[model samples]
Target: MRNMLITGGAGFIGSNFCHYWAEKYPQDKVVVLDLLTYAGHRENIQSLENSTSFAFIQGDIGDQALVEKLFTEHQINCVIHFAAESHVDRSILGPDAFLQTNIMGTHTLLKVAKKFWLDAGVANHHFHHVSTDEVYGSLTEDAPAFTESTPFAPNSPYSASKAASDHLVRAYHHTYGLNVTTSNCSNNYGPYQDSEKLIPLIIQNILQGKALPIYGDGKNIRDWLYVEDHCRAIDLILHKGKIGEVYNVGGENEWRNIDIVNLICAKVDAAVVASPELLVRYPHTPCATSGDAKSLITYVKDRPGHDRRYAIDPGKCHAELGYHPVESFESGIVKTIHWLLHNQRETVNQ
Candidate 1:
């Protein structure tokens, strides 16, 4: 049985991957390493405690000694690197954490993996790095989507750090002969996602009867991948993908930021049984007693270096690994809204 080390396994996509792996590959032992940062919550993967196939450790990936120790003790055969400072706004406010975690932490993992795998004479070992499509920069209205060959032109500090890590992983493969694969995915929205993200933020605002803040004119576009679909694509890449190759995973469903916010407002209002009038604190706000969540939409000043659009061409992943998303934007948004409401209900009940 293989020993898999999943960094940042307590975060949204990473925790979902932990659940998926536990159910699909029960024979393999899973070791999750997370530093319990603000974005990483242990409760996200608490369900794994009942399973003999999973283990969680609280530690930083940048700690070379700890990482090396885990690799040596567990005989780790695969590394799924997901620990990174992911929020764009946070990165803009302070890029140090992004650089430290995404770049230096990745370098640390690569160093340890190369040393342990080579010394153990482990064959067929794989190292998979999770990344974002923002590394390709922005796309215009008529421009084609980002492909594996897209030239790197990262716009934000967060994307730049991820790009650096991606390059390091590629370099390790070429120089050290380490089996490596990378997947640059589009924006993901689903259950267990931090409310700071677009979809969940909108949901939380609607529930609290607060203004649904949208940056700029709210016309910015992004390809929205369901979190579970992303997990499945990563699984396929780990098993079927060729060594030293990069695959782009996308939802193939593009939506403008404004349109998605509007969709969530409508869905949440319809799903929740509470009276809209009672939820609102100020009647002058957009969210009055009209039972319309769209009333809450308020445009604000846009942040610096906000990419106009991001889209990914996943033709290679589909053709090479037969990857196809099971959820469309329409269906996925509905699921996300329901999940937030359900969680909110559970919290209130407790």
Candidate 2:
């Protein structure tokens, strides 16, 4: 692969992919372009800053001029388009930013990549668009996972925007014959993820004795994939995937919202007994010795258009791409809980 330009490389999945690619291709030059939105933190890539092959730029991917300049200067042959407005609740509050970043930004990237691919000389080009399964709308309790042929039925503004971007990617490939591959993955949870998400938010609250907020009895189900495993799937698709095809990446680890939170609380409670502060609390209050984080859970109203259940089959990726998650959710969540407990010094929500 030639120069790889990964947009939103500082965000959760994008950042994880950046580190993964940087470590995997030590000699290949990788550049990251991020808008530094609330969800992104440059400090996430602190360890990789010293590598000459990796470069970081604080900018929006929607900037046409800057995008063109990067394509020209870096001779970027691969585009891992990850920049987008991802928060479903936030999108409900404010959709303009989502349309601007998710839809318009993708248009800008496709325009630039098309030019390069059409004029490609002794180089291969690909734009791998990262997306979510929410684009398939809410699945019923007995419904099967979404496949590549699943008709787009986005509900929330976030999924709608992502669907628009996915359409744009497909159009570029069909109309202009630009090499592009798309992946719609399920919910991802792991280390270095923003605290606003489900797992990290619950983990942070339990550590500080704060109320863990659950939406609408917390029965909504989501298939969780380890971020690193998602990164590996993206890598396989980028190299071996056929042009103009869509892939679904998931670990098949499905759990209800409250169930996952309760499991995390039990794990954290057992681990917190080893903590110095919690040991002191146990001596003062005999009942508190239980260290039950589950006591803090409080359910609230659900957001508008909440998808009840989403389970990705990932059979296409597994069979065609030979892509399967290496880390099970059990092992992944254990490691995630421990990382949060160790990094509890930060009161950061970033």
Candidate whose lDDT is highest:
1
Record all residue pairs in model 2 with backbone atoms less than 3 Å apart, i.e. clashing. none
Residue 328 in candidate 2, Cα distance off native in Å: 1.2
- List, residue by residue over 213-309, the lDDT tens digit for candidate 2: 9999799999999999999999999878999999999978999999998899888777667677655533422224564688889989888889999
Judged by lDDT against the true structure, how good is candidate 1? 0.88
Off by over 4 Å in 2: 120-123, 277-290, 348-350
RMSD after Cα superposition, model 2: 2.5
Residue range with the least summed lDDT across 10 consecutive positions in model 2: 279-288
TM-score (all chains, Cα) for each model:
0.94, 0.94
